[model samples]
Target: MIGKKKTDATMILSSEDTRLGPSFVEREEVYTPCYCEENVWKLFERLARDEDEWYAVVISNPSRTAVVLEQRAGSAENGGLVIWDYHVIAFRAIGGKADLVLDLDTRLSFPTPASTYFSRTFLPLDLLRQQFGEVFLKVVEAKQYVREFSSDRSHMRLPDGRWQSPPPDYPCILAPDGVGRFEEQMSITSEDVARRREARGWGTVLTLEEFRDRFL
Candidate 1:
């Protein structure tokens, strides 16, 4: 792992950090070190400054199955931000620094392994179907599901590059208890899955079956 130390010039502390204690890393905290049109990274930087905890940033493209890992020291310059780009498929540790390294894709809210603070955004697979159309299904092809698919089916692609099809029979399988899978599947449309799910009254939007069940 690349080690960094905190630099006085870049840290921003906040009260949420005190209440959450060590676990208070906001989604935006780890994002600051990276460059993006949106200043999403600033959120995490603020948390790092408040909590005084180190973080790792993983830039990923699941469609390409590629990820980059970098170590940021809590008490270092640049908010101890580090950026590493490489083609690694699974998790691995660097220089015996952190207990683990998490590969965060700011597009999916998957549970990362323990010992590492991973930053990943939740991109509902169902919504992906609506957005990328055909390309969206590639993410499912890239990963193997543990609980979502009732069959050992290995691969599928989305249609129209705008919406991904739920497994032929498993659309509602991811729904909350009492919610029919078919009904839930039918409820999602290409135009609306990305909107705030609470407004639509859908339970927690759509979640990957694997992470939801802790199968992975």
Candidate 2:
């Protein structure tokens, strides 16, 4: 589940350097703002499905007000930190070489070094105020996520049936065999990483620190 796993794809060390990762994923071509989950779905479907070398990273809070920093879309408020009810990204772990992160909204590189990304993206717990809310992480195997995750874009709709934000041009992502398991997958949220060592149907729930120690 963690970085030691291997994949059949070339271990090129950097997706950006190669311009195309496994399955020829071009980040800019596939990315859309506010559709991080779907963007990551395509990434894993292309690059990480054959093996365990990649994982989907979900960051959010029980309050639906997770705070993150240095996002390109962030405003001047909170020193340019952005508040996302939830956000998703793809993580690739290459042994010995630095691991990488693929965050569509970050000011950082498309596939940034794991260590740099964390240091620049996350606010320290000590500095975090209650108003900003706290964030937890879910790190799931890309294979598992691609197979189990589905979204109808219901979360983006207004009661009048108009989209709060424009939907992706691509059709909604559906679970394999049409299982429709998005909520079931999101239900595996928790920060007590040690207590939940065994991976659940979704993945392991981890605090930011636990996520770093385990996945970073």
Where is model 2 poorest over a 10-residue stretch in terms of lDDT? 1-10
RMSD of each: 17.4, 6.8
TM-score of each: 0.20, 0.80
Model 2 residue runs over 4 Å out of place are 1-24, 48-52, 76-79, 96-98, 129-131, 177-179, 187-196
Q: Write the per-residue lDDT of candidate 2 for residues 33-109, one digit (tens) a residue.
A: 77788888887767753443778878776666677877767765655578777788877776623377777777666
**Per-residue error at 60 for model 1, in Å?**
7.7
Per-residue C-alpha lDDT of model 1 across residues 1-216, encoded as one tens digit per residue? 111222222123234222333433433343322222112222332333342322322222223222222333222343323332211112222232322222322222212332323323223456534653211110111112112212121122335442232333212223234332322221234333344223342222322342223212
RMSD of 1: 17.4
lDDT of predicted model 1: 0.26
| TM-score of model number 1 | 0.20
